[model samples]
Structures are given as C-alpha cells and as structure tokens.
Target chain A: MPKLFRKVREIRNFLRSFRCSNDNSNSIGFVPTMGYLHKGHRELIRRSKLQNDLTVVSIYVNPLQFGPGEDYETYPRDLERDLTVCEEEGVDVVFAPTDDEMYPEKPTIKIEIPGLTDVLEGAYRPGHFSGVATVVLKLFNIIQPDRAYFGEKDFQQLKVVQRLVKDLSIPIEIVPVPTVREEDGLAASSRNTYLKEEERQAATVIYRSLLLAQKLFSSGTRNAKDIKEAVLRALLSEKLVSKVDYVEIVDEEFRIRDDQVMEGDRLLVALRVGKVRLIDNWRFGDEAV
Target chain B: MPKLFRKVREIRNFLRSFRCSNDNSNSIGFVPTMGYLHKGHRELIRRSKLQNDLTVVSIYVNPLQFGPGEDYETYPRDLERDLTVCEEEGVDVVFAPTDDEMYPEKPTIKIEIPGLTDVLEGAYRPGHFSGVATVVLKLFNIIQPDRAYFGEKDFQQLKVVQRLVKDLSIPIEIVPVPTVREEDGLAASSRNTYLKEEERQAATVIYRSLLLAQKLFSSGTRNAKDIKEAVLRALLSEKLVSKVDYVEIVDEEFRIRDDQVMEGDRLLVALRVGKVRLIDNWRFGDEAV
Candidate 1:
C-alpha cells in the first residue's frame, strides 16, 4: 500500500527523512489527478513509476479549478477504488488532503500566465487556469519532485503548466504523456463517467473532430480556418452535442492560428453532450512536438 | 573569492552535484540581495552563515520590483565591492544574474496576495509585492535552499514573502533578521544612498516615531489612531521630510487595526525625504514574536 498523507508538513518531513535514507532513489516523480481513476491516469502513473525511483500520486478534486454551475460538487470521487488502482500501480506515496488541509485559509495567493491562459479553455472558464497554476505550483513545492507527469489530455492545461514552470523557474521537469483513448477514440477522462451510454457514444465525435483536423492538415490543408470549419462541422454533425464550446487552433505556445496552420500547431475542441463537457486536442502534422 | 553563478541552470546543477558530495554540510542558506551590500545585508548573511553549512548571497537588482518612474535605473550596483563583502563574510556562492539573465522575457507569471498586498507598501507602490513575490519565488526554486533570510527593514516585503511561502507552500523557511540601524536610529537601506546630507538627517524621524509608538503602548495607550497621529506628527516635524505615505498599524497577519493595537502587532511606516522612499516597522511590545 502507498503511504498516505493528509497534511503538508508531515509529508515534507517524510520526504526529507526519505532523502537521507540510502533506499531513496533520490528521484521523486509525481502525477497529480482529480481522482476517479481511469486509463489516462494509469498511463500517467505508469510513466512516472518507470522513469523515477519513487512515484507519488496526488488525488485532489481542486474546487478552485471549477467555476459557478460547474461540476465541482458532483465530481466523481471513490478514494477506496482510487487507492486500489495506486496500489496496483505500485505508487510509493499518495497525498490525499482534505479541503481544510489543502486550504486552511481562503487562499490569497494567485498565479497567472497572462496571454497563454486567457484563451480557449481559459476564455470559457475564467479563473480556471489561475486556480490550476496556483494549486499545481503549491503541489510542486510540497512534493519537491524531480519530475512531474501531466497528461496531454488537458492540452491547454499541460501548456499552462509547462509555461508556469518555465516562467517561474520551477525546478521540476514536466513529463507530458500522450492522451489515452478508448477503442472508438474517445479520450479517457474522469468526466466521461458523467455521460450516459448514448452520450458516451456521442463523445467519440470530440476525438473524431481532432482526427479530422489532423487528416485535413495531412492532406495539404495548411489553412487553420479550413481545418477549424471542418472540425466544427464534424462536431455539429453529432446531433447530441449540445454545445460546441470552442474549436481553436493554436501553436505550441497557445498563439491563436486563424489562417496558416503549421506543423506542431494543435487543434483543440470542447463540446457538451447531454450536459457532460468533453475536450480533446490533436497536434498538426505527422509527429508530436 | 566566493564562487559566482549568473545562470539559473548552472547554479541548480552546481547545487545538485554539491548535494551528492560527502563534503557538503547537507544544508544551504540563501540571502538574496540587490548588491551594494549594507550593514543590514551583512547581518542577514552573518545569520545565514551561522545557521547553515553553506551560504549563498544573490546580488541581482530585480527590475520587476520597481514600478514605472521608480528607482530601477538608479538603484545601486557595485558588484566589485559587493563581491568583496561576500568574500569577507565567508559566503559560499554568489548568484548574480544580469537583467537579461534573470528576466529573459517579460514575465507572465504573477504572484499576488490580494487583500494583504493592496495595502501598506503595496498600495504606495503598485505591483511591487507581485514583482517581489515573482522574483523571490523564481530564485527560491532556482536555488532550492534549506532556509532563506530576509531583513525586517523591508517589513512589508518580509511579511509578503512569509505570506507567499505560506500560501504557495514553497518549502523554504523564511528567517527574518532584525532591522539593522545606523547610529542615529534610521533603518539601514540601499535607498538611503540616494539621500542628501540634510535629507539623511531628517529620515531619523521615521525610527523615532516607531520608538514613540512603543513608548506610548508601554505607557497604556492602545488606540491605533492616537499612535498613528503621534507618529505622523513626529515625521512631519522634520522640515526636510517630503511626504508621509502611510503610518499603518496592523496585526501579525497584516489585518489593519485603527482602534486598539495589541502586543505583537506592528506599526509600519513609509515616508520620503527628498527623492528616496524609506520604510520601517516596530512591534508594539518588547520580546518579539
């Protein structure tokens, strides 16, 4: 069983002591999650466990990341089953802090990446990336991991985290794992659980739109407008998709690409199917940057 | 001569290699400065040297902390003499990056403590603490020290750093050294270099007012308004004193107090004599908390 921690001080003390011991491989790799463990989380955990001496996973459904009318209160959480998955994956430690433990006081601290986080998902969910950056930075400090893992599933989030570490000189290396998918190409997400069987089938259209952007890009379509329109058309084709939140084409740096789409640019999509929002992205060209 | 580093990657690598060596004392103490080492900085370095196995003094004038029309261009920089001070003080290393090195690009990451920062020195100098917090946090991560020292001369800066660390869980212990004063009781500062002969003499009133606050509190006065009025009167008595920015009394957490000031509560003041701005603070009662 992975060692469980609720308080920040106790785990810091533990990591310090662990560092002094000969058994400590001296490298801690972290994977932060919002629980309700799924295949995407497993891939992140598996990668961390492979690359580092010790792997620690954080299970936090951060309320700060959710906005008004968002599913923060109803975010799926089953700690017992999540712990089972961690134990199966041989995680070294698990930090599962209570709300009081994580935020003893109403937080006054805010971390923002101005231009990078103000578009796409950031545009849709104001203060969402700020909250994500704040909590992620806090976790990075608390864990003091040599390298941390983030899934490409949250592409904008991954970019935000990467830029955050780069801009702030955070010492941890961020390892980006590819988005895991089901047989029909639906991105594996904890939010996927919220979808009904029919809604789940409709959700695959999100990934299909991403692939459609890739297919268009591959077939001599360099114009972001042409790709975006095609992707949006595909999403709208799915009658159940209640809302097409955004179909954005941004370079690796989240610079909006409206006309010419170059290699390494990503097409990100967000759509709601039967009240469940699903988001996915695909890099332009053949290989991922 | 203390070893010098101008790059973040270089210092981080050095610290890592040093950590693995048996010769390392297994502890690092950091004192970040703006060069032109003064007695207050010397005291901070002295305390760091005494408490840890190694001491690092970073001598970079962070441009971010200076607002438009403020003292960024004119702030003191005498690296040759500053290095001499570090060598004499038995410092282990000096990480002094140039402006381009410290901020290669315009910073996007901002760390803000909203309610706490929007008052005191924060109010007078907008985006000041945000800049301070951003740079300090970046340096802290770059130099992963066991402990970092701050001077109470910049009382609000110290508090801001403390709150920043607490809020972000930065895993660094902020050790605040007492404000080192000159023979006339004025707080030691780099900005004092800008003061002319008569202006220098007038600045002593800032500290005198602090002492007066202590005396008034000791003699059974708890009213913050009365103490603030007395301090303001004393500051205004100096003919050369230009402006009284603020004379604030706040509890330990920077909750402003207008009525009753209790023990451990601090009286923070900011004033200008000539073109230079100076700030100082005093705890209401003796036996500091």
Candidate 2:
C-alpha cells in the first residue's frame, strides 16, 4: 500500500527519510492529478513507475485553476477510488491535500506564460493557465521529483508546463504521456462523469471530428482554415453539442496556424455537449498525407 | 581561488558534482548580487558562509527588474573586483551568467505577487518585483540552495522573495540579513556610484530620516501619519534630494499603516538625490518604543 500524506511538511519529511535510507532510489517520478482517476491517470502512473524507483501521485482538484463560474464546486472527485487505483498500480506514495491545506491563506504569488496563456482555452477561461502554472510550480517544488508526468490530452497545459520548467531552469524532466481514450472516441477525463447517457454518446463527436480533420489533412487539405472549418462543422453537426467553443489549428508551441497546417501541427477543439465541455486534439504528422 | 561558472548549466553541473563528492556538505547557501560588491553584499556572503557547508554567490544584473528609463544599462559592473571579493571571502562557487545565457529567448514566463508588488518600489518600477521574483526563482531552481540570503536594505524586495518562496513552497530558506550602512549612515548600494559628490553626502538623509522616525517612535509617537510626515519632511528638506518618491509606514507583511503604528511596523522611504534613487527602512521594535 502506498503511504498517504495530507500535509506538505509530512510528505517532505517522508521523502527526506526515504532518500536517506534508500541510496539506490536515485530517481523519483511524480504524476499530479485531480482525482477520479481513470485509464489516463493509470497510464501516467505506469510511465512514472517504469522510469523511476518511487512514484507519487497527487490527487488535487485545484480551485485556483477554476474561474468564478466554472466547475470548481462540481468537479468530480473520488479519493477512495483514486487511492485504490494507486494501490493497485504499485504506486509508492500519494499526496492528497484539502483546499484549506493547499491554500492556508489567499495566495498572492501568480505565474503566467503571457502569449501562450492568452489563446484557445485561455482566451475562453481567463486566469486559468496562470492558476495551473502557479499550482504546478508549487507542486513541483514541494515534491522535488526527478521526473514529472503530464498527459498530452492537455496539449496547451503540457506546453505551458514545459515552458515554465524551461524558463525557470527547473531540473525535473517533464514526460508527456500519450492521451488515453475510451473504447469509443471520447478522451478519458474525470469530467466525463458529468455527461448524461446520450451526452456521453455525443461526446464521441469531439474525437470523431478530430479524425475527420485528420482524414482531410491526409487527403491533401493543408490549409488550416479548411481543416478548422471542417472540424468545427462536424462538432456543430452533433445535435447534443450545446455549444461549439473553439476549433483551432496550432503547432506544438500553441501558436495558432492561420494560413497553413504543416506536419506536426495540431487540430484542437473544445465544445459543450449538454453543459459538459469536452476537448480533443489530433496531430497532423500522425497520419500520412 | 573560488571556482567561477559563467553559465547556468556549468554551475548546475558543478553543484551536482560538489554534492556527490562531499557527504557532509548538506547545506548550500546562496547570495545573489549584481556585481560591484559592497559591504551589504559582503555581510550577506558572510552570513551564508557561517551557516552552510558551501556558498554560491551569483552576480548578474537582471534586466527584467529594470523598467523603462531605469538603471539596467548603466548599472555598475566590475567583475575583476567582484571576483577578488569572492575569493577573499572564501566563496565556494560564483555563478555569473550573461544576458544571452540567463535569458536565451524572450522570457514569456512572468511571476507576480499582486498586493505587495503593486506598491512602493513595485509601484514606481512597474514589473520590477515580477522580474525580481522570476529571476530569483530561476536562480533558486538552478542552484537548489538550501538557504538564500537577502539584505533588508531592499525591504520590499526581501519581502517579495520571501513570499515567492513561501507561496511556491520552494524548499530553500530565505535568510534576511540586516541592512549594512556606511560610517555616515547611507545604506550601502551599488547605485550609490550614480550619486555625485554632494549627492552622496545628501543620501545620508534617507537613513537619518529613518532614525528620526525611530526617535519619534521611541518618544511615544505612534501615529503612522506623523512618522511619514516627519520622514517626508526630512527627505524633502535636503537640497540635493531632487524628488521624494514615497514615505510610508507598513508592517512586516507590507500592509500600509494609515493611522496607528505599532511594534514591528516599518517606515520605508524612497527618494532621488541627483539622478540616483535610494531606499531605506527602519523597524520600530529595534528601539524602546
């Protein structure tokens, strides 16, 4: 069973002791999550376990990342289930802290990557990337892991984290695991629980639309406008998709591709299916044109 | 002779090797400076050497902290003198990277502490504290020092750095050393070089005004207004003081004290003598009142 730590100091103490006694345990791998663990989290955990001697998974639905009217209150959480998953996956430790514990008082410090944070999901949700960067940096400092895992599902988030580490000269290696998906096409996410039975079926459109764009790209549609238009049209075609938030084509750096979509450029989309917002992305190079 | 590393990667590599070879060298203390070492920096270096097994002194004038028309271009520099000081003081390593090295690209990542950064030095020098926090954090990550020393002469900067570490949960201890002064009471500063002959003499009024406030506090004066007024009066009365920027009373956490001044409250002042700006602070508890 993995040892659980609720307080920051206790975990530091535990890691210190663990380091002191285990000379052979030179590397530690960390996976930060927001609980309600699924195969996506399991993949991250597996990647971490394979790479390092000890693995720590933090289950925290960071309130900082949620904007005023967003899903801070209603974000799905299941600690018991998350803990069981960690135990079953042969994890070494788990850090699960309360809101008050994570934020003893109002946090004054903020971290932001300006241009990258001002587009796409960031444009839709103000202060979201800053909050994510702040909390991720905090967790990285607290855990001091040799390597940390972040899924490519949050392509923008992954890019922001990478920028934070590079700009700050942080020593940890950031490993981006492939996004895990259900047998159908919807991306594995804790928020998937919020979808109704039919909405869940509708949610598959997010991935299907990405495939549509990929098929178009593979068949010689390199103009970003055409690919984005095609993806947006497919997402809006789904009746249960209450609103289509954004359909954008961008390179690995999150720079929006306005005219042309080259190899490795990604088609990312976000839309709401009956009040639940789902997002998915497809890389251009994945399929030959 | 102390080892010199002009690159971030080299210093990090040196530290990694130092840590591996030295079993008892558990603590690494750091003092970050901007070259042209003075008594203030010497005191900080001394404190680090006394407390830790190894000492790393970084001397880089961060361009990010200087605003438009501020002293980024003309900031004092004497690498030969600084290296001699480090050598004489027995510093273990010196990390002094160039602008191109420290910031290879346009730094998009910005760190800000809202309330504290929106006042005083932060107010006058826009984006100053954010720049300071960003570079300081970058240095902390690169060096991974156990404790970092900062002088109280830069009271607001010291507070901002402390907040950065506390809020981010960076494992380094922020050691605050007392403000060092010249025989006549002017705070030791690299910017002092900017002051002309008479301007240097006039600069003493900054510390003297702090003493005036302390004398009043010692004489049972408890109103922040009275203290600020007295300090401001002293600063403005000096003929060479071209501009009196600010004279305000704030507590340790930087909350502005409007009415009553209590124990541990600080009287922080900033003013320009000639083309040079100087800042000084005095804590109330240091005196009987």
Off by over 4 Å in 2: A17-25, B20-25
Model 1 DockQ (Cα-based) = 0.60
What local distance difference test score does each model get?
0.87, 0.87
Docking class of 1: medium
Pairs in clash, predicted candidate 1: none
Write candidate 2's Cα lDDT for B1-289 as tens digits. 7899988888887776565444424779999998899999999999999999899999999999899998888999999999999999999999999898888986788777887998988889889988888899889998989899999999999999988887877889999999988998888899999988888988888878888999999889998888889888988899999998899888767899999899899888888898888888889978421
Q: Summarize candidate 1's per-residue lDDT along A1-289 as a digit string, tens digits.
A: 9999989889888876665456334788999999999999999999998998888899999998899999999999999999999999999999999888888876777776777777889889998998898789889988989899999989989988888787788888999999998989898899999999999988888877787788888889898888889999999999999999998888877889878999988888888998998898887874422
> What are the interface RMSDs of all the models?
2.3, 2.1
Q: What would the TM-score be for candidate 2 when compared with the true structure?
A: 0.96
Screening candidate 2 with a backbone cut-off below 3 angstroms (N, C-alpha, C), the clashing residue pairs are: none
Each model's TM-score, in the order given?
0.94, 0.96
Question: Which window of ten consecutive residues has the lowest lDDT sum in model 1 chain A?
Answer: A16-25
Worst 10 residues of 1 chain B by lDDT: B16-25
